[model samples]
Structure formats: structure tokens, C-alpha cells
Target: MKVDWSPLKHELGEWRAAGLTLPLWWRDDDAVAPTESLARLESLSATSGVPVHMAVIPRDATRSLADDLSDQFIPVVHGWAHVNNQTEGKKAEFGMGRDAHAARLDLQQSMARMRDLFGARLAPMFVPPWNRFDAALLPTLAEFGIDALSTYLPRQTATPIAGVTQINTHIDPIFWRGTRGLVPPDDLVAQTVALLQARRTGMQDNAEPLGYLTHHLVHDADIWEFSQQFMQEMCDGPVRLYRHDTKGFS
Candidate 1:
């Protein structure tokens, strides 16, 4: 029998129905300003009882914060350098913004740097800048050992890599482009609520976790303040959080 889905009830049904394993990642792109963002990530990891993911630039050729994650958070390479390539006809894409030749080169360099330093701790996932990447750059991910990519909604139809996994997001905490920083509490709540709704009513396509992306540099102070609370609310409400591997996506 098809289970009747509500908010928490629907999510719970999927968990058992599809044997779903939900993985929630905590993102803070561009490590330029590290103090407040890292602090909040650390606390959230400790309190959340789940592993939090940090995407670091490490272009400084340093691993200060990655070495000091306190075992609660996991570190992944955000990018070699968080530079802008919006002028290339897109506003937020990094490597994908480059031409085919340049994009592949950047991917190779990033993978080498990541493996040389982070090794096993390094995830084979790339979260592009601005949550934007061209579909054409998809194949380059596999060439660089990036077997998985976390992007925004409307995933690529043609899978780029032979055995790669695609984890794209639909919800974001901050109201970027509109308010930049200092996002209103109501907006953040609304965004989370939409994700919560998507989690139910069989809206989400698969058992993938309700993906939410964030940019610490652009996120408002109020976001850091309420992120944990919002997460708690979702967990208490209807969403079940698990790792990508748990859901067989990693």
C-alpha cells in the first residue's frame, strides 16, 4: 500500500520505504573570513550529533583549520582559489566557467592538491562557487577524481561521469543577491519550511537528503545565530538526516 504522506510522517515513511539515508552538509564557501563561520560550524557539528562538512579553499596552501576540526566536522576542498568568472556569461560558476581546456586543467590541479594534503579525508565532491556550473563541465569532474558533485536544483540530465553521484540542492539559508547580508529571520525560516514541505508530499525525487547550501561570507549574522535552531526544528519536525553513503548516493 502507498503510504499517506504528511510532513514528518511522509519523510519517515520514505526513510523506511526506500530505506533512505539522509545526509545533511554544512557549507561555508570562500575561506577569506574564517573566525565566525568556523566557530558556528564547530558548534553545530557538536550539537547536531551528525558529521558536518566544511568546504575549504586552502589556496593559502595551509591546513590550519582542517587540522583543528575537533573530530566533529569533516573538511573537503571547496576550490583551489575562490575566484570570480561571472563575466564568462555566468555569475557564480568557477571552474565550469572556464573553457573545456581550462576547466579540465583546474579540475586536475584541484584534485592533486587535495590528495597531496588531505588524502582520505578529502571528499571526491566539488561544490562550485555561487552554486552554479555549466552542464558541459560535468565530465571534467571524473577526470579529476571528483566522482561526486553537489550543485543546485535542476540537475544535469546527462550524467557527466561514468560512476558518479549527483547531489544537488534546492534550499539555501541566506538570501543572497537580494539582501547580501543581514537576512531577515522570517526569510530563512520560510526557506527551511519550503524544504520541509518538499521533504513531504513525495515532492523530492528520491531519498537524497533535503539539500541546503550556504555561503558563510555572504550569509547574514542572523543566519549563524539561527542556523542551528532551524536545523533542530527540521529534525524535530519531519526531516530525517543521514549521510549520502547511507542513501547509496556517495
Candidate 2:
């Protein structure tokens, strides 16, 4: 699983020469409680100096999790229940086949629960389960006090709605459809290079942070090791860290 990484290093070098910085961030989803894997993840983040946005499912989230979180972590809402209400398609908590009124109720309740559990620790961001959500629900996010939306792939628009911004992850190390192990490191590195190159050339939104996504609860040893190495390498390059307050880019 050794990756060449030369292409990415070279591209980063170009950015350094131009005095430009690559905005970088990390997000890990489906956290409801503390576990050994989460402890390891926190350790890795401490070592790499990259803060992790822990996407917590509100219905299952506990106050103990909020207490355990350090300054290096940001807790964001991960959907109402993480339940797949769809009958015959990709699993989704906020997708089609669900009644809009019911969905809004779920969201409202989730917001209340999360606020009670996490208090001021919660970031006003919503991450739909399975990276799938109904587009029709975008306008309603601000009504529930959500300020941002996160999903897979590059974001199509920075602000899907006036008050809510969108920022998405581009690189996921796990091969979910396969072994769910770390994807071939070489392939992952190549994809990272291409994604950065697109931004450098203005083919994509350069303002958006290059995001790395993970699911710590399911990480095998190989995935954990790969994540550590990949994150360390990214930090070694000309990368600027992104915080929730990062303006304009969301």
C-alpha cells in the first residue's frame, strides 16, 4: 500500500513557489460514543495537527461524547437518526419516499437533542447519512439553524441556500464496495493529485478546502496506518488548516 506521492508533492511545491496555500480539512462521520478507535483517531489528529470534525448522529449521541471531545474536535450533527427510511434504493435519512412534514419534525427534534447534549460544542452543520439528502430540503436547513452542509465529492455550489454553505470531502481512503480496507495508496494519491491540480488550474473551486473523510469506528489497522501517513504527508505540504469560522469558503 505504499504510494509514490511524488506527483502530489510536486504540485504542492508549485503552490509553495507561487506563495499559495492549500486549504485542508478532515471529517469523520457516524460518531455517537467514545471507543478505542476514536481514541486512536484523536491521537493521530494530535500528531498530525489536523482537527477532526466528528459528525455525530443526534438521536444516538450522548453527553459523555461531548465531554470526551477535546479542543481538536468539532461535533456536527449527522442526521436525525441515521435511519434509512427509503424502501427500495440507496439508504438515506433525508431522501425521497419520506414525508416532508415528518422529515422536518425529525430535523427539529434532532436539533433540540443535539443542542441539549452538546450545548455550545455543536457546530451548526448538518451531514446527511450515506452522503444522500433530498435537494428539496436545502431551503429548510437555515430554519433549523444549520449553517453548512457536508457530503461526498466536490461541492457543486458553495452556497446551496443563502444562509447555508456547502463544503464536501473529495478523498475517502476506504474502498467501501470492496474490502473496505484502505484503497490502494497509489490510486488514492493519484486521485489527490488530480483533485489538487484541478483547483490549481481553476478547473474546480480553489476556494474549497481539499477534504479527507474517514469513518473511525470501522477502521481496520491498515486504514488507520494509511490515514496517519496520508494526513502527515498532507501537513508536510503547503496546506492551511480550515476551521468552522473560515469565511466565504464554508
Give TM per candidate: 0.77, 0.95
User: What is the C-alpha lDDT profile of model 2 across 1-250, one tens digit per residue?
Assistant: 5767788788889888888788998999999988898899999999998889989998988778888988778888899889998988899999976888999999899899988987887888899999988888877789988998999999899999899988889999999999988898888989999998888888999788888999999999889988988998888888888866443222
Which residue pairs show collisions in model 2?
none
**Total clashes in model 2, counting residue pairs 3 or more apart in sequence or in different chains:** 0
Which residue runs of candidate 2 sit more than 4 Å off their true CA positions? Answer: 245-250
Looking at candidate 2, what is the lDDT of residue 40? Answer: 92
Best by the lDDT measure = 2
> Each prediction's Cα lDDT score?
0.59, 0.87
Model 1: how large is the Cα RMSD against the reference?
5.7
Candidate 1 lDDT score at position 24: 55
- Per-candidate clash tally: 3, 0
The number of the candidate with the highest TM-score is 2
